[model samples]
Target: MSKAHELLKKYWGYDSFRYPQEEIIASVLDGKDTLALLPTGGGKSLCFQIPALVNEGICLVISPLVALMKDQVDNLMKRDIKAIALTGGIHADEVITLLDNCVYGNYKFLYVSPERLQQDWVLEKIKNLPLNLIAIDEAHCISQWGHDFRPSYTKINLLKPLFPNVPMIALTASATLDVKKDIIKQLEMQQPKLFQISFARENIGYFVYETEDKGYKIEQILKKNPEPSIIYVRNRKMCHDLSFQLSQLGFQTTFYHGGLPKREKEKNMHLWMSEKAQVIVATNAFGMGIDKPNVRTVIHVQLPENLENYYQESGRAGRNGEKSFAVLLHHPSDTVSAQSQFIHSLPDKEFLKTVYNKLCNYFQIAYGEGIDEQFSFNLNHFCSQYQFPVIKTYNSLTFLDRQGIITFSQEYSEKIVLQFLLESKEVIRYISLNPQDEEVILAVLRNYSGIYDMPTAINLSLISRKSNQPEAVIEATLLRLKEKGIIEYTAKNNDSSITFNEVREDERTINRVSKYLEAQNELKQNKLQAVLDYVTDKAHCKNSLILNYFGERGTADCGNCSYCISKKVTKSNSEKDSNVLLKLIKEKPLSSRELQQITKISEEQLIFALQELLDNDFIKVLPNNKYTIN
Candidate 1:
């Protein structure tokens, strides 16, 4: 066996590499730059991982998401491999120590974000390490034509000259031909070998249903499937509300989203991952870098923004090669909802400029200044201050972040800090004077320590629960106490933070990337249209349509999706049942009930057969509304 296969068996315990994985590993081991387009759950990681293991030096892996990077690092460490992820919020001294470990401690893998590469100290340290390979996860983000483009990713090629001879590998779950070409160019690869496994998930059956009531449909699907399933919604409110609704209906359920706190998110994910929760209702944020092989059903409560997201989300099901389903439930209102959510909320160039200007002004950053300045940003308050629509303004900030104009962190958090001005006995005396504040003060004193020494962060929700008071009332009491100088209190109700990456040059900054802005808007429109077409068109095979969209040709139906199933039913009934019904109808004119009594077939099949005959002019409805052979 080759070293790659031997290392894979030793660490992963897999008897052999999956198809094309071995081939991709061979190409990478040959010191070739490679781009691999494997679908989600296709073991894309092992292709780079095994090669890195076979090599002598540490592999540098660059990714965009902190969560994904952490997950991979954790997995590698579990296998007794030394790996480190240099994510955000790390101190300079700590980063230096981590880099030192990579150089001297014989670490095998180092994961860092694209933005981290922009730092001079990091790049300088990287040039000193003996690099083996450069692995770019979620490599599609490097392409402007890709769905999740990040301008920071485009600068990753800066590492190429530093390690002139090290081979590179770019990996993504889904990418179109345009994205593929763009990736090669952006990475400056020299005649990179391309390995694209088929994007078709044959084990997954795609289904779309149009219904007036989505909740009922969801319940029905869950009841029928009764397995580990995921129900995806569009927003955090829907994620939480639907999970609660399902729990009330007697489902073991949990929820996940980006806005959730770190501890709570991990807790909920643990419950679901341990099979304690049979159903997990989540937004699109739930599934990246997560693998659950036995997911039997994945139901979308609303239309996805695009097919790429749909394919990736649905591909999470049936990874173990058992029969599974990926269902999409659509209502008439969903069209309007999707339009509003995706299209109308898209920020134009003018709107982008307005948001950037307002953001600089909000932080009191003068023009020609504000580079590298960070601040706690409350998105709701900022929008309310300027009377801007919340969604559009948020989208504008996101666009700015993607364009590398700023770094926007949308993880929601609430912070409350408290410090007592007086000693412990003096706090007791003050509480005695203000009896109404006794419960709140006592709860704070009982649950927290060192409040008299310095400002310590406290959980407002926990304090409310402990004091048996509402959060609003607790906030008011704290403000009253602060007003009277009893204690020092600071409350920060912020959903996000922003760091300006460039000096304030409002219009000039906006104009610099206007082409990207226009192209991305047009791309969103096209992608949205493709999703709508996928759900609405019932004549073609859904599997084939997906394959064709990804530049596959000469595809065949899987004989399992919703469209293919319906076609099978129609063919079966039209050939066998239609002739049987015609023979009975020819003997005598009969109403539909009379026909059912004679044929004893299902009403659905009977209706389909009758419609087929009527369309062919072989039958007609008499004046009495009875069926007759024409």
Candidate 2:
């Protein structure tokens, strides 16, 4: 066997690679820069990973999501591979140690976010590492035309000069032709080999239902399927409300969102992964690197802002190559709501400037100051204080971040720190007095060290496992301990945060990218229109429409999609209508309006049958626009 296959078997335990994965790996092993466009759940990671393992030095993976990085690192570590992810929540000393490990300790993979590439210290450190290859995940983010564009990703080109000899591989799950070209040009790949696996997932049946009572439809769908499923909504509140509704209908359901605490999110995710929950209601934030293969259905209760989001989210189903369903439940009002909330609600340039200025003032940063300064942002408080609309303000901040003026992150894992106020002897006395909380207290002390000297991160789950108690019990004990002045426990806070990348400037600075922002807004409107077209157009094949949107042409109709199935039913019913019309005409001559009242078919179907009869001389129309038997 080849080295790639051997390592793949040894590490990933796979006998062979998926289609185009082996080819991509071969190109990478041959030291060629490659661009891979694989659909979601298509094993894009293995293409770069197997090659990195076959090669000599460490692989530097520049990714956009911290959750994805952590997930991959965890998975690699589980297979006895050395992998580390350097994200925002780590301390500087720990980062130094991790970098040292990557350079000298023979770590195989070092995953960092795109924003970290702009840090001079990080760049200097990376120049010293024995990097064999650079892999960019979510590579489409480098393109402004892509759905999820990040300005920080544009700085990835800086690494090209530093690692001129090393080959680079850029991978994304979804990208159009324009986005693909932009990625190559932005990364400056040298004679890159392109590998695009077809985006068609044959095992998935796409269905769009126009429903007035979505809850009843959802319940009915789940009742019929009754398998592991994911229901995606638009907001956090809807996640909880829908999950609760499902629970009331006797479904083992849970919900997840980005705003939840770390432990709670982990618990809910664990429940769903372990099959303890049959359905998980979540927002778009829930499923980045989720590897559950048995997810039988993914239902969208609300329309996504674009086809890209819908395609990627729906692609999460049928990972095991088994039959599954991606159903979208939408009403007319949903289209209006999505367009208004996503497109029209985007703040104008003046509003964005106002938000930026207010943000600076909120942080008390004067002009020419606050470069690299980080602050915890409370969206509710900020909005209330400034009397600005919450959604608009949030979108403005996001756009500002995308313009590279600031760095905004809302989805980092929260860390809980605990420091004991009492001395060791006093703590022991307190624990002895409160023996009910002894298990949790001792578990915390045993699992995490230096909590008494300084505030250190405490793992509630680990404590729960060690104590053989529920997480709730452990938390209650910690709260009791904190109340008695034995320890100072700080709970995890998962709020949004912002960092100024440059000193505060005038409104002109914010308007520097105004044209670009306008272009993005226009692109968004177009995407929204495409989504509306997909949901509303019933004559075309759903699969073909999606494929065409991504620039894939000449796709045949998927025989199992809702449109194809409905067309088959219509054809059968039309033949029956023609026969019924003939029988009715044989009884006696009838006018068109009289035939319509007698026939049990729709007007369109009746007209179609009448035209067929006329062409065949089976029926004739009189001068009064009446139909009669011939």
Candidate 3:
């Protein structure tokens, strides 16, 4: 028994390893970059978590879900292990402190969001740490062909050189052949060995139903199988609406979406875990980081934009090796709505540029002005700033953020602000060369709390009003201090999460660069659709279709899907028996006409055919001496 197996037994309470677990750990222990593509519910966390404990240094796990981070960390802590998750919810000072602790605190696992990887502090800290391994959960996000593609994920390769000697592991439950290659390329995996398990959920009963009244249909499903369920809708409002409906029907239901405040989101998630709300009615955004094993059913009241999403959301059910239902309640209009969303969301090149320009101009930003600055951005303020419609412009800005041109994290944009890192006496010496900072230094010190050690929360408007200085002068003074290495400032604005350097480039060059970015997005979306084609396909066996998509051969249809089950039904029925059953039923009033058909054939043969039809329930015999098709 190795150290990993020992921890698995002692902490996780598992006496033995699952299939391929020990092998995957051994490969990592040997210091190899490994990609583990296991099916959902295959215990992927154990493969990475156990190795991190047995290894020499800390394991850095990159994931997008805050709920998932908290859950995993909490579970680990319960077992007397040290784990922590760093997300955007905490203050910058808190984050720095957490990272510092990870460095010197002897923690085994440190979970971080992808967004954190973009920050200078995060990147700088990782460089100095003796990292044991890097684990990228949902590695498919790095692939353009995946359902969830994050542009920041493309920059993941930047971490490679920082930890050249450290081995990395990329784990995802779902990925097509194209996605696998993309993940490797995006991460620049070192010719790594890939362990891809077949994407098959034999215990999940797959059912796709088309209905006219979605709410009523959902009510019907809940009435019968009222176990722990997830009701998926397309938007935030719909999640609330259906959750209310289900609650009215006496089911404990709660909803989740991005629009909710982070606190409320976590609260609702807590309610879900405690079974206070037995069902979670939410949008596709709900379950990415969720790992509830006993989800008895997943009902999609509305259809997802593509099959990749549907497959992932459905796979969340029956994680405990128990039977579960994945039901899709789709209508003709749903298909139309999904298609329309895909088409409408395909922003054009000109639109992206115009929106990008409007956003930059609204912030009064020039070609390259904001570098390493964080700001509070309100989307509505920008639209009001330029008289542009908020919705479309907001969408465009997100696309730009997705394209890595900007970062728009705030719901509202506040003015630029900062404070002195040094006191007035200390500031005097610093400003001796310029002799122009005395007034501004006093103004910043008189206001803005806690500026000496940690960066104070700054709203530029307050500083300007108190200092009686123009906004430009205040902005300029802060920039000078930042340049002089005296203090740092973050500009909070609404729109793209982009940080532009003060380096000015010709306007034409910027436009040309924007065009290339748009071109990349267009190509990426097409590749994503190619993966969707594999998801909704009804012609082939699920296993064989997935295998073939990934360029695998010697694959056959697994007798486990809806199609395979239907085929088994057809095969069990003889063609001649099907014909005889149909003819006998139409002839009517044939009392046990079993022998009559028998007289037409040999008695033994006729009896056998009738029994086959009866066994499959293709025909029904009435008490009134009449046989009919069932």
Q: What is the C-alpha lDDT of each candidate?
A: 0.85, 0.83, 0.68
Candidate 2 residue pairs in clash (backbone atoms < 3 Å)? none
TM-score of each: 0.77, 0.80, 0.67
lDDT, candidate 3, 1-630, per-residue tens: 378878888897888888888889888888899999887667889878888888788999998654567567766765767777764435567567678888788888888877778778778987777789999998987866676676668777888999998888999877878888899899999979788766666677765543445676577667778678898887767888778887888889888886665447778999998889889988766775478989888988765555556667888999888988777665545656655565445656666667766655665666755443544465666668677665556656656555444544532233454555666577778767676776676677766556776767764434543444544466678888888777877665433233432232334434645654555556545644543444355566655654565556667666665445545543244466557656866665454344444446432234345546666887765655355677
Distance from true location, Cα of 285 in model 3, Å = 2.5
lDDT of 1 by residue, 273-356 (tens): 899999999888788777899999999999998889999999999989999999998865688889898989999888888988
What alpha-carbon RMSD in Å does predicted model 3 have with respect to the real structure? Answer: 13.1
Q: Model 3, residue 629: what's the lDDT?
A: 70
For model 3 the local lDDT of residue 624 reads 58
* Highest-lDDT candidate: 1
**Highest-TM-score candidate:** 2
Query: Candidate 2, residues 7-81: lDDT per residue as tens digits?
Result: 988987889888889899988888899999998888999988888888789999998775687678767866767
lDDT order, best first, reads 1, 2, 3
**For all the candidates, what are their Cα RMSDs to the real structure?**
9.7, 8.1, 13.1
